[model samples]
Target chain A: MTNQKLYHAHIEACVEAMNACNLSYVANLKEYNLEKLCECIRITRECAEICSFTAQSLSQGSQFAGEIAELCAKVCEACIAECAKHNNQHSRECIEACRHCVEMCKDLMVAA
Target chain B: MTNQKLYHAHIEACVEAMNACNLSYVANLKEYNLEKLCECIRITRECAEICSFTAQSLSQGSQFAGEIAELCAKVCEACIAECAKHNNQHSRECIEACRHCVEMCKDLMVAA
Candidate 1:
């Protein structure tokens, strides 16, 4: 596939994951109000946000895309570890998404 | 301000800008399906997402906070430029937000 196509595929998957995590995080926040999980929630939220912008940066062929992608991978790792602690379906789904994004971030970083 | 307080202040402003831009972009997407603006839309979405995450990361004292903030600044620059093309109230508002984000990003990158 062309770089453009590759970008779309990778970024779309990551974006999907980020979106899922964001939704799940919001729902959990409302239902449980677990202030203790605030740290985890913060990590997840940041990872989701980074993934969103990274997708666009990748597509636009931004010069910083590679550097950013690498940073995103680190962020995703923290998020995945955090989500693993929660046993909910939402958290599981989020973990799955973060894994996918982590893979994409690694790949993009190499290409960049 | 304490790092904690500073983080809240900076990230909050950036997040506000990002959220404003995201909402405006969604509304614009519905009213006008401009394929040409797809690039702009993409940038807006990414920046918004990143801003959200960056805020969380900043609050938690993530080690990569500085690097991510730098990336956010780059993303915000592109977003601001794109938003400037439109004269709509939403676009205008988005541009203003992006400007605030860019400044915060620069500062955070330095402190990081």
Candidate 2:
């Protein structure tokens, strides 16, 4: 997740990035009519959801901010690796969002 | 988050729930060109994201499963209350998702 108020443009960027990964995952799976990459798709969805959740919790000042941020870092790393395989604007956007999330989560862990 | 492997239809249900909330939040706010509900929209995004992330982390057997589930409970509660104020199918779907997430989170906390 991200802080739009603080990071600026992160809101749109993150949403775009997430949507890109999700949309592509579902679309590709549907077109292929195979479940070969279902795990990856599922992970992408998870990555998207957690980032969104972490951002909100931080904004709301949730108590587990540190733990949440730590997990966010892990998920971000995974998602970044997955999204990087694609060569599209959405993948690019998702990579950026994941990168930003990784940085924020690391910072949060330290602050915690 | 949900467990499609265990919860059967949880995957579709959760995705539907989250998409409903995110779509409506962004669409309505954009159409109205009003920032009044921006906070709520942001929260909705957060709620959707966290559930997804939590589900994935649990599936992967993350170390902070218990704490993640606990935070999930709190966010789901807040989202339920906020989503309840809206009387629509999307809100209904979101409500179900929130309900499911709450139950799962509570159960996870207990098991932890």
Best by lDDT: 1
List per-prediction Cα lDDT, in the order shown.
Answer: 0.76, 0.61
Name the lDDT of candidate 2.
0.61
- The residue-by-residue lDDT of candidate 2 on B13-81, one tens digit each, is 343345545654554455463455566677788877776666545544456777987887788788888
Q: What lDDT score goes with residue B78 in model 1?
A: 87
Summarize candidate 1's per-residue lDDT along B1-112 as a digit string, tens digits. Answer: 2366668778787779778878765655554335445456557777887887788888877888888888888888888888787778888888888888888888887787
Model 1 chain A weakest 10-residue run by lDDT:
A27-36
Please give, for residues A1-112, the per-residue lDDT of candidate 2 as tens digits: 2222342233323333454445545444554634555666776778767766665455434557678879878987888887676566655666776787677677777867
TM-score (C-alpha) between model 1 and the true structure: 0.50
Label model 2 with its docking quality class: incorrect
DockQ of 1: 0.03
Q: TM-score: which candidate is best?
A: 1
lDDT tens readout by residue for model 1, A36-67: 45556557667877887788777776778778
DockQ score of each predicted structure, in the order shown: 0.03, 0.04
Q: Lowest summed-lDDT stretch of 10 residues in model 2 chain A?
A: A1-10
Clashing pairs in 1: A46-B53, A49-B49, A53-B46
